[model samples]
Target: IQKLAGGDICKGRIDVYPKTRENIQVALRVSRVNQLLGADFSAEQIKEIISRLGLKVEAAIKGGTLQIEIPGFRPDLTREVDVIEEIARVDGFDKVDTIFPVASVRPVRIALRQTMLRKIREVLCHTGFSETVHFSFVECEQAENYLSSFASTEDKVISLKNPLSSENDTMRTSLIPGLLKTIQNNLSKGQKPLKLFEIGSVYFIDSQGKRVQKTVLTAAVLGPYELTPWKPRGKEYDFYDLKGALDNLCSHFGLQVGFPANANRSYLLEEKSANCYVDANELGYIGQLSPDKTEIAEKVFVWELDLQKLEKSLPPRPHFQNIAKFPETYRDISILVDRQVTSQKASDLILKAGQPLLKRVELYDHFEGKKIQSDKKSLTFALSFQSKDKTLSDDEVSPLFETIVQTLKTELDASLRE
Candidate 1:
């Protein structure tokens, strides 16, 4: 009986009972043996042993006899001694300890890339810009019309075969259209003067005909510089405000920028915008809201910097230098040229000819009159000169200024006025 209940041996022969309660009579009959032999065993303990031997055993009193129910899985656990053995084995589980293992320690710090992104987010937050999260999927029409050069048939885009709506059919190619649409949606909800930013992935075709992904940081400001219900009048955002924000961002990375006068007109305002460049490579664009684009966001000014390019271009840290110890020499040259001549051309000529002494050149005035030639105008420039070793004098600077004027005159057919 012990061998069968302890799973040490299989029962060689088993007796079949006619009634269901007959198994209980057989179990009680085996328990009498343990009692008569002076072995410590209870009816409950015997039933537990029977359960461990893969049999369902139940006890009940009917006509003063202990009845039992035996399930079909275990014919070996026929008697009460078989049930008692399994109970004794399982009772040892109470001696086992209950405790958890200790975990290992982790180093304290984030990865370098994650740290950089956090700093970028903090900088944007400090500048009154709220961070926004958007889904990659965007409306097809908005993606094509608002985002520049997005193609619907491009395999790079993970399109939805069964889209829930037309608005969420195609994956976003750029962050601008989604942000602008968000601004428009907020405006409809009575939110104004929205200043928002998003840093996210943008997928596009690269020069090598492979699909490339880049992490971009984009920002937009719409409506006024200041909002007040009581005042009812505010200064609207313009190109310079957006340019200043971009300058701040680049300054954080210790970069110096020059605004070229010639900016492409297709995607931005030609007169109020400029393409950003670093080391002669075009970085991005900052511009005022073109009148046509202003339909969605009135008086909006936007700036987007390529984070991939900026990350590669940013110096580790910034350094400072002492201001000039010597006084600067100034030269003013007025050139009379045809109205068709651009300031960019005149500036380029001055820079190319001035060479060694020209520190800076700025156009101060532009005028046209009846006294001048019918097709000509007057353009004035202020040129600054300084030497690292000593202060420059008129004699040392005038000759170089003359060469600059002569170059403009010969190259652009410009003439000195006064």
Candidate 2:
């Protein structure tokens, strides 16, 4: 038998594998066993059950406790709960009374951030942008190039220690690269009116060399604005289409943001791009992609925003208001301001100066023609006025209207266009 077991019988030597049972001792308490099983189990009864299972039991250091030594064959008997389970098994589980666990039941709530993200997704989907998902792994060079203009020179892209491939060795610092690739692929497949968005984590290494990860919302619109049977060659999407989609998202969240001209992004057209902000906190940027950088014949517009910052800027849950008892009257004003003066600046001034009575402001017209000075532009805004308590007479609106006009003139040097 020894020879058959590959033992050196001729040398008068044989190795008994697993020479002794493993020395695993578990302390089983009488009170704990009774409490768990809901049965009055004395220490002697537990010891008798354990001994029946071929386990050696000894008196534990503390009274009413037993030290149980588990056999190598009974590998499952390593914990005190295992001993209790065995006692229950030997004593017959049918004897144990059925008792439902007691716990406080409450309705599960969806987290606020999660709800916010879902709303963002819903708004973008309704605004004609399709959501996309891409691998977090990105090309090192592509990631670096995208982060270069926005991130400081000291900041770097986080690289993988054990990369699957050289091409995807680094974590993405921006979602734009992946979305750009998606655009290229879809365009190649002849997909038109392509609008895509993604909500995903972007990785970065701060100036302090700490790896940082953040959630960002990125969206892009390309191809035609819309396809119509009448027009086989539809109008291509422009900067406004991108901004309008962004506005839809912000409006849904009750977030008011500003777009000031920014020339920092290398991937976007300097003249076309603007930085998005809520007060002084910068949320992100929106603009037309630089044709040379994107290498696409058709124009592409995109925006990327920090979702955390966006969440911070979102207004509280809006209070319900009854429909106005009175009618809303609108007044139109066209102002001629210098070419460099943004329409947003003029609109903000109007909103501030025309408050209390001014309910809404809409820039309905923007014209730059031979009639206007070469260095100036024409902007027309429709101001809606309404009173909650009473119908607003022209007397009430006229003064606010003149105040708005005068404020625009004094602050922006804007001349009221006849």
Candidate 3:
């Protein structure tokens, strides 16, 4: 082409491109070529291919790496894979074997925290709550209102050193505010019966005065309990509905948890909220959102569990218990206790008093009106008595029932209701 152009385009040898520059030298391994192409090409064949392509090919060193000097014209051939491609092109693409590359794969061990996160997501999804994701930022006022409860001091709001905007200047200390915002947004669009959840980090300063970020699982529910063909507007979701969802989650993880009294938050209705616990440590809080927090007319219930604490609270691999071959005996017991005494405390007392024979304890009824004393409340529990080896007889369960009643009366000053 230069000769036809009749210009000094190729006068003498203009070394515009460096032929032997170190930048153009690429190391190639015969094994790597075969590994990539899934073909067993010999070193001799690869070397011959490079020579034919007008590129310099050094003899293979002890490590089987051949130093191939790329030509100025073939500037693209700067890496081992590039030479492998050239070999594949010259060796006839059809001749390259079509086979799975040899590899040794091992199962990747997943972190337990990650596993729990995935499981929590699955459980929440199965429980009819749609998952939501939001930015880690919130307004300064919302952060102060919702997050002050989590920090030991009021000014622990974690502000961004360089935030994107004035609106999202601070990290969220609690997921409740975000969930409330979501509820408001959804309600504005005429979406009803909102059941939503989020699993993310909440930032705060701990008692030790260190900035901390914790993973939290939070869920919110509003509107009807259930929507059905028969009842267009089903019963509105009460505190128990939200509690039942928390119970469902606890049951799934085999976590032995309880709702202790007076788990209050500034935004939560004091009488409708309780602190959840695993052992003695506080796990989280669940309550009815105070009406003042939102413009939504219907009541909203939400629960936020410290996922970090929850991960620690998760029970060990449960040992399989054989299905009971014998029948279970049911007993009804109603107790009169002071209004201040929690049903959970009574239930725990009953479990302790009726151990070994007490298979289940369920609170079926709670009354506080004229049917009970003014200063006290009545809690009716359906107790199940069962033995793993044989059916429980009335004679065998009577002593335990009496013991439970006496224990409650002695320990909690609770009397068996007539």
lDDT of 3 by residue, 1-418 (tens): 5578666554476665644555477888889998888888788888899898888987646587788888767777877898899889998999987776568999999998988888888988898889998999998888887874455554478889899999899999888877888898888898888899998888976666778888888899988756567554757877877888888888878876788686757888887888888888788888888888765688998888888888888876865778889999999999999988888889989998999989788887888899778999999999999998888889999999999999998988998889
TM-score for candidate 2, residues paired by index:
0.73
Clashing pairs in 1: 24-68, 49-83, 50-83
Q: Which RMSD does model 1 reach against the true structure?
A: 14.4
Relative to the true structure, candidate 1 reaches a TM of 0.57
The best candidate by lDDT is: 2
Q: Which residue runs of candidate 3 sit more than 4 Å off their true CA positions? A: 1-100, 107-110, 161-166, 188-190, 207-209, 229-234, 294-296
Model 2 sits at a Cα RMSD from the real structure of: 7.5
Across 1-418, the per-residue lDDT of candidate 2 in tens digits comes to 7657766446665558757666787888889999899999777888888899999987553788888888788877778898899899999999999888889999989988999999988888887789999999988988888885346678999999999999899999889888888888988998877889999989989999888888999998877657567544657777876887788778777777787657487888876788998888888898888888777887888898988888887777875778888999989999999988888889989999999889888887888899989998999999999988998898888999999989998999999998
lDDT of each: 0.69, 0.85, 0.84
Q: What TM-score does each of the candidates earn?
A: 0.57, 0.73, 0.73
Model 3 TM: 0.73
Model 2 — which ten-residue stretch has the worst lDDT?
Answer: 225-234
Cα lDDT of model 1 by residue, 55-117, tens digit: 554456444334556565556656666644445456553533455656898898886567668
Off-target runs (Cα >4 Å) in candidate 1 are: 1-128, 146-157, 162-164, 189-192, 205-210, 227-235, 258-267, 270-273, 289-294, 316-323, 329-349, 360-384, 405-418
User: Positional deviation of 351 in candidate 1, in angstroms?
Assistant: 3.9
